[model samples]
Target chain A: MARLEETTADGRTLMRQTPASAEAQTANATLARKMRRRGEESRFWWLVPTIYIIFLMLPIYWLVNMSFKTNQEILGAFSLWPRNPTIANYMVIFTDPSWYKGYINSIIYVVMNTVISVTVALPAAYAFSRYRFLGDKHLFFWLLTNRMAPPAVFALPFFQLYSAFGLIDTHIAVALAHCLFNVPLAVWILEGFMSGVPKEIDETAYIDGYSFPRFFLRIFMPLIASGIGVACFFCFMFSWVELLIARTLTTTAAKPIAAIMTRTVSASGLDWGVLAAAGVLTILPGALVIWFVRNYIAKGFALGRV
Target chain B: MERTWNNKAWFMVLPVLLLVAFSAIIPLMTVVNYSVQDTFGNNDFFWAGSEWFDEILHSDRFWEAMGRNLVFSAIILIIEIPLGIFIALNMPKKGWGVPVCLVLMALPLLIPWNVVGTIWQVFGRVDIGLLGYSLRALGFNYNYVNDPFDAWITVIVMDVWHWTSLVVLLCYAGLVSIPDAYYQAAKIDGASRWAIFRYIQLPKMNRVLLIAVLLRFMDSFMIYTEPFVVTGGGPGNTTTFLSIDLVKLAIGEFNLGEAAAMSIVYFLIIMLLSWVFYTVMTAYDAEQ
Candidate 1:
């Protein structure tokens, strides 16, 4: 599918070189002029994204705005920016062991899940891209169905399953449960990237007496470095954002930040400031992750790995 | 790409196979076991063949939740896909604008899903939220907690705000991959902007768009946390989708047999729908 554009573009180039008539040169000039005018007129297109970004930012801005204010400022009036700004709301999360532990637990499992998902998915993705195994297509689709699965279906059973193993209330339980979806996602994305690499690289490495693992780590992996980055980002994104399975798998010891927020909301009255502050804090890790891999996400997904 | 038939590749796949089996197959077996049988307060069981499934299929509550899930998914897809494409098209092709727009756009996707619900939940409160307060000031009766229509609209808008970026990012990826030569050729042929989009950009974007659609469809269909947080499927059960209802049945009421059967049906519906989407899109892809 990707080759379609390149082939047609090649054909157009060849035709461009062989002009038809004297009138064609004049036609080209006029077309160029029209294109320039179109470009100028399309400047208004920037406003579209500008408006969208503003919309996306509004709720977040409200969250952040509420985070800095105390309960008095929040209930006192509806303000765009907090008038009496204070950090006491953030202090509650930072100082409290129970609250801060949620962030720690969330990060621990998300990292563990990303590491586990990518490590296992790497070899499988290579296998799918390089060789046609028996039932490979069926296997691939089955793996993806796991990604599409509703967490609710798995939640109760997952609780029972993990409990039987005495894995409940542990970080690893949450991490492994997340892999039910993240592994499939990592495999799908990595396979797309691996397929884009030329097979000759594999052949050449083998001829050079490189072992399979050695070749994968030294040669093949480097070629798809951006792909690996993209896969990791997705794995992290899904595992971090997901709550249902994570919530069911753990009650207190490994409760994710999300579950903690829900618990706090229910147990105590609504502390909009603290909740909003906690929300902003939860957003930071993801924002930082995105910032570091921002370029890779843009460029790598252009391979249409999705 | 050509591949030699290598049975040993199964070794590479074995790790994932085992992991998923332990995580997916075992739990699925448990659910299956529950669906086919009866259970009392204790672990007592009786032989009941498809009894729970029968009840679930016959229930209006089940069908209504299923219908709500369908409508919700359809609404989000209809809005997100086109809006994402439009924004992606307008996004700058190069320089500083690229990363700036991408980072800001991606912010929502990275936040925890429940927080997304909370952000909107608080943002739409008639008392304190900006959107709700502004609407009230303009003389519109806006209260999501009381009005079912308002609840649904709030949920839809929150979803649109949160997820449209994903569509934008995916479409932008495809748009960027389109070589400038195609655009140049279209210009040489005096093609209209719409023609260039239809013939060039749209086809190149087909794969990414397929992924976007599948992901959005699957996620929206199974939506639980966001809507559950925003509306609690409430004002009544007006906003309750399958996942929300299944959670309530399975966890809240602890009706294991009925919930297990409903979960199976819920899962099968998504699986069947996704399979259809995968086939139809790939078939179209093969044609191109």
Candidate 2:
């Protein structure tokens, strides 16, 4: 897959005089070439994938390996794989109300945030892609600026703002806080997808006497279904994995799994097994999400619209 | 067409504008307010008039944190971008290996930020963790908890492991977009490997590279969760970046004015850099 050659047309004159030296050099070159070609043809393909897989799997293997062992085992043993695997740690996380509720809270806010961001971003992206109005360029750039705003800087302001509005500890506050970044990203990605659709389609629909809403819903929406899926997936991923803003915005009722996980470590000691179990569980939803969206991620980027 | 151009199109965007304004503008105003005033509980406030800004601007602590953030971002970019591209180059463009490779690369990106920190925190212990235990068994003294250098290395390595995949995925998308004709052309021209990458692939990947660079820079600069989870910005503020320090000042210490000033400064820095990136990328795109 990665091969290159350099052409030297003028080398024919030099090649004629250096046949003796060239014959020996060519013999060695041919031998080296044969060896290299053999390497590529035989095991090179397998080697590439194997290295990548091992690189990717090591940390996850370590996490799962620790999760199966007892805390004492984790502290005392250094096994590559668990010797006597146990499910006691998994039970701790699944059975405990505090831990379980964290997952529920995380889902609630992430779904809410994703829904809000995608719904809002759809029209905005459409407008930016299709219309050239006053300040449209400026507005589009301004939206992207929000995506660049650091969540840490907004933490204090978000907390104070939510608290003042009596929205602290509510799922809405967390959802709203996430929109600061998610909505902008949704708009950007969706806008790219939307722009790729020819404007003549909209013009054709208008010539046929179709209204704006009807044209958008009937024609434009179906054309960009995959784009919407891609945008929603990104919105879900960012909102799902984010911690700093979610932690700052919620205290009790809406605490995400991330905040709950942080509490697992205490002055007494780290709960290695339970923590690993929680970590395992934390990755499950994202795994499922990426699986569902896996096909679209590459395809979406392949369009080169975003 | 003229009728479609009416202001009713503005209504299409109204929901987003309202949502963003409520979420972003209101809090921004609050930060602006706090940056210029002193608050002493029970809603009591006194006019400080840029004193907080002046203090933050002049403080060695702020400068140090800024320096650390810049260095961390630079290191992450240096490691991630090329490594990601190299990995992408090796990735399978066909067959079952494609999905397997992609899913594996995405595994780290799936884990929540704090959990990532926790994973490393446990994974780095000399007594209990595999990494620590194995390294110790192999005759290395590495202890991230106490050694400042180890702590920095641990944090940087952890981040690279987590985020480099994002760049890989982005670059892979760019790579796959190139037409087969380009490769055929290169082959016919007898182009050298370096020439192909320099003249063809690199130029084609520019758009995605721009996106990758900007996203990575912004995220690295704003990094808080992983380091906070692993080190708690500890061993005496060695890993304390601007975000961690802002949280400590605002929530931990309850110094609203100073925190607010710091946040504004933080926001400005991010905004300025992002604007520069956007302008440069867009201008380059236009030129192309």
Best by TM-score: 1
True contacts kept of 1: 0.67
Error of 2 at B109 (Å): 1.5
Which ranges of candidate 1 are over 4 A from the true structure? A1-40, A296-306, B281-288
Tell me, by DockQ, which candidate is best.
1
Pairs clashing within candidate 1 = none
Query: Candidate 2 on A213-235: residue-level lDDT in tens?
Result: 89889999998887788888888
TM-score of chain A of 1: 0.87
lDDT of each: 0.86, 0.80
At residue B40, give the lDDT of candidate 2: 68
**Alpha carbon lDDT at A146, candidate 2:** 91
Cα lDDT tens digits, model 1, B1-288, are 788899999999999999888899999999999999996767889978989999999999999998998999999999999999988878886668888999999899888999999999999998889999999999999999999999999999999998899889888877777754566688878788788789988988888888788878888999999999999999899999999999999999999999999989888987897678667765875676
